[model samples]
Target chain A: MNKSERLFQLVLLLRSRRTAITAEAIAEAMGVSVRTVYRDVQALVLSGVPVEGEPGVGYMIRPANHLPPLVFTPDELQALLVGNRMVQAFTDQDLAKGARSAELKIRSILTEHLKQHAEQQPYRIPILESDDGLREVHGKLRRACEQRHKVRAIYLDEKQEKSERTIWPLGMIGWTGKWTLLAWCELRHAYRNFRFDRFEALDLLEENFRTTSDISIAHYLQSVIGMRDPG
Target chain B: MNKSERLFQLVLLLRSRRTAITAEAIAEAMGVSVRTVYRDVQALVLSGVPVEGEPGVGYMIRPANHLPPLVFTPDELQALLVGNRMVQAFTDQDLAKGARSAELKIRSILTEHLKQHAEQQPYRIPILESDDGLREVHGKLRRACEQRHKVRAIYLDEKQEKSERTIWPLGMIGWTGKWTLLAWCELRHAYRNFRFDRFEALDLLEENFRTTSDISIAHYLQSVIGMRDPG
Candidate 1:
């Protein structure tokens, strides 16, 4: 790592531990010599990081000296924890994984009080329903939307008429409980919102399309607003 | 707080500190007697919390015995910090405030190691531009949609003709860089997506609307799929 990164790591190392950490331990963790650790500590102290050291004991950062930016009020912490749970429960598996990982990271960083506060928070977004089929489709469409891939799907319309259409996937929008894929349809030659459950099969194509101003989501929404009709 | 809450708080109090805390300090922080603090610590030890108590030094929770749930990988921590910054940069002020507060909470809890990781994540989402008028309008529409309120809006159509419409706000949809109000337009007697910039005036009426099956976002999305045109 760079000098700046090493210095930052040193600070975080000190912050993570509650007791004084010895220069030998710091050197071991940071992959440097005790002399280097001492030099870095000196550099940090010189730069107003308020790192305290004892000759025989070790080093510690005095509380409230630096890093108020990381501090959160109780309610904020509660909200974050709850929000993570909600995301995990509500979104696709990839997002759920991200939320879970995010929550774990958040949990690891919290002080004991905040950790307890999070654990005891009353809110819960229990996984009430889940369909593996829908999750697979959602994940596929989400990836397509992000990567701007075209999708060919056998869709069942309102009247149960089956048709295969290739669409340039723009976005996966969640409306209440349902998910809709907003796309520029090749058959309709218009922007259409395809319902997830109505698709018998979805084939993500390798052919990619450039996001021109005409086919952009903004342009499509403008057409929806009757600002200009692309249909 | 209840007994369970007190027990949890006592555990957290012990966890937050690097050094052993005296019973007097615990009592003062917990708003309990030193005797009660001692009793709680004893209760915690019996409950398998691995609390270490010294007569003169006071008490501390042994490291790694609890709180694995809160720990985060370096990459995960980076994602969260970046995500929060992105939310603050991309969303409206109210959501930005929430994101900021959430970041603070996450920061406050992070061990120095993770804090350093977050700081050195080598990614940024700079606020390139902001429009206060757009933000205000977005905020207003968001609230109306959330509360299912009737909104009276003077809108400029494609022909530049102004028309007053009382609409039931269903959702505020963001497409690319633009935002649209998805509503049940009273004038059109159909679902209409109104672009934010074209709204000449918007009044969030005190009159709220019930989310009937016909007017719900899910139902509207179903219509967008050509399942049934609610128009």
Candidate 2:
């Protein structure tokens, strides 16, 4: 490794340990001579990088300087990219956008060389397929859910009966290629789930609602499916 | 800023834009003379930090150099410290430990001066009152969750009836003052929500289960509360 790289690694090792690291210990970890470690420590110290403790007593990194920029190994980058891609593919609309934004921010932090490799990296995450119409409706529903806006829709039941309803969207779920919206339905005077594909027309009303506490749409579903007690 | 710092900032600016930056542009950005910008650029190039293009054509960071260490600004560190502290406070056993581990890892990466400041920094995130028991259950539950082992617990229902149960813990929730676990109950043969405060005699079973897909427990909770339907 180059001098800069070695220094960076030394800093990383020192920070990992709670106790002070001796030069001999640092030498062993970096596979360098004790003399080289001493020289490197001196260089770091001279360069205004913090090196705590004397040569024999070991060293501890004093946290007062700016953090080094985030550096990711190739595999790490791949993991993040894949995870973000998955989020964009499967998440609700507002969350999907957030995921995309995060990916962009991460790219901005990468060094020039790594950034190029990242761009050339052909990592792809498989996304579950959903109907185009359903995807569009799910996107709008997600926005309404986030904004706590009221929505009006013509929902078709499992029995194929149509009903007009207004709801304060609380959350949404994607299951087995279908999208489900969990909302506080005004018509039912209760929380209800409506299938996106079964909805003929969905509209975001001007009316907004207060945000509720964090609750699981899955638990509601399990209860609705009789897997758990509704109460 | 020092010449090195200015050079670093200039490189960052060029990389962010994905375009060549002229010495004139660098001088303007750093409020320095063009001569100083030229000298700084030369120094960076001499140090083997890649800068592409001739002087007349402007300079661009070559996308091939290894990134410097991960650095965080003050505001960024504060944000991370706060977010991680919250996660440590409210999350399940495994996640809280992970948060601690992450904090340790972050500390290791800081420059020496920053390390001192970090040690002296009196910024402690206050734990919320409701999730106090979260600290107690965090370690054990986290390990069990990570291992995917069966967990035995004395659970209390809304009616205050106590029942012994074994569950496959899938996720956790921290809301207001309550810590809830989303788990696949072997007893019920379905997913259920159990409050951490209500759990007694918690034990981890030896046998482990296969890892499930990544499902957000929050979404699951919404469904449980009649906010959404599972179908």
Candidate 3:
């Protein structure tokens, strides 16, 4: 094993442990002598690894995360890669682009020789939806929710019937392949769920909402599973 | 650090390296003497750590995922949290519920101190759709795609017109807020993207498909973003 890899493994073991482990036990575990263990421990401490212990007793890692961002283990790299790949495949173009860039940055840090193992992923997240405008709509809804603005939209029903209505926007829900906007309908005098695809056009109103009157996202969560699309 | 942790680090370094590292190099990197490195190498050998070396040469760890599953750095945990939270907050009830449970399980394995930091996440995934049926539809379509079965559905058009059509199911794409089925429509004689909510009823046919001439998911991804619902 290379010195760098051994140091990384040391960080992992120390970080995972809750209590200190004895030098004799550590020596036995590593298949080394007591003197060797003591010297290694001193080396780690001098190099700012925060390894704490005495010569006779034992050693343990500090509770705080003092390591730099680039100090990652092989498994950590795998986890990050799988996650970024999943995001790239499932989300809109903008988010996918972001994930791709992040993957490149992560790859750049893996000490030149260790790069290959980290780059060649053992698993892959399959590509799914690739909508161009989904993230744009997401941004708008997010703004509306944060500003508590009322919104008016021309909506199309399953029968292709058209209806124009003003709604008090609450939250946006993203399904695996679909998106829905939760709101209180001024026309129906009740809570309504609007699908993003059904909206032909939308305009954010200048007015803010009064949360005390209608159902909030939190309240809606506590009530029941009301996911039936009221088309 | 404890001897066990150091030993583990040594193993990690060796496993990731393509070439052997010299004892002097190991000693300098670990901040220890050459004699200490030699003794540690012997200890690791006796304890069945698979540390390979020679009298005047270097050492390396065998290629293996032999490290315990619990070995995780703080950043890896953070990556897992962000991914799972995105799935929980954005997807439907079933996936969200699954994510919530998984977070709890991952937390259970952590040391008590680590548990506190993991539980009160810096960010939150808000509940969106509370539908109990979204998961069921996802399952059926998944089954159809995997089995390569032809599926018939009572589809609702954007114009609200109802039409019964048979389709060769290709793949299901799960967007953050949508669920779409990519298939070849018999009536249209072309590729079509069908939204899950538009399916009034679905029936999987007892027929398997033979791929010949059509734009596949990979091809579509490469050529164009054909996610438009041809309602």
What C-alpha lDDT, on a 0 to 100 scale, does residue B54 get in candidate 1? 79
In model 3, state the lDDT of residue A167. 88
DockQ of 2: 0.04
If you assessed candidate 2 against the hidden native complex, which CAPRI class would it receive?
incorrect
lDDT of 3 at A7: 50
TM-score of each: 0.42, 0.36, 0.44
What tens-digit string does per-residue lDDT give for candidate 1 at A1-231? 545456656766787888999999999998888899888887665333457789889998866534443556665555455445444444456666555545544444567687665554323233435566777787788678767789999999889999999999885544434567778999999888888889999988999966788886667657674443212
Candidate 3 lDDT tens digits, B1-231 = 445445555555565455677998777655678887787777677655677877566797665444432223333444455555565543334444555554555454455544664543322344445544655666577667656788888999888889999988776655445668888788898888888778888999998775563445554544566443210
- Model 3 residue A153 distance off true place after TM-score fit, in angstroms: 26
Candidate rank order under DockQ = 3, 1, 2
Off by over 4 Å in 3: A1-231, B1-63, B66-75, B78-82, B85-101, B122-130, B210-216, B223-231
Candidate 3 local lDDT, A50-92, one digit each (tens): 5778656578876544332344454455445545555555434
Question: Which structure among the candidates has the greatest TM-score?
Answer: 3
> In order, how many clashes per candidate?
14, 44, 31
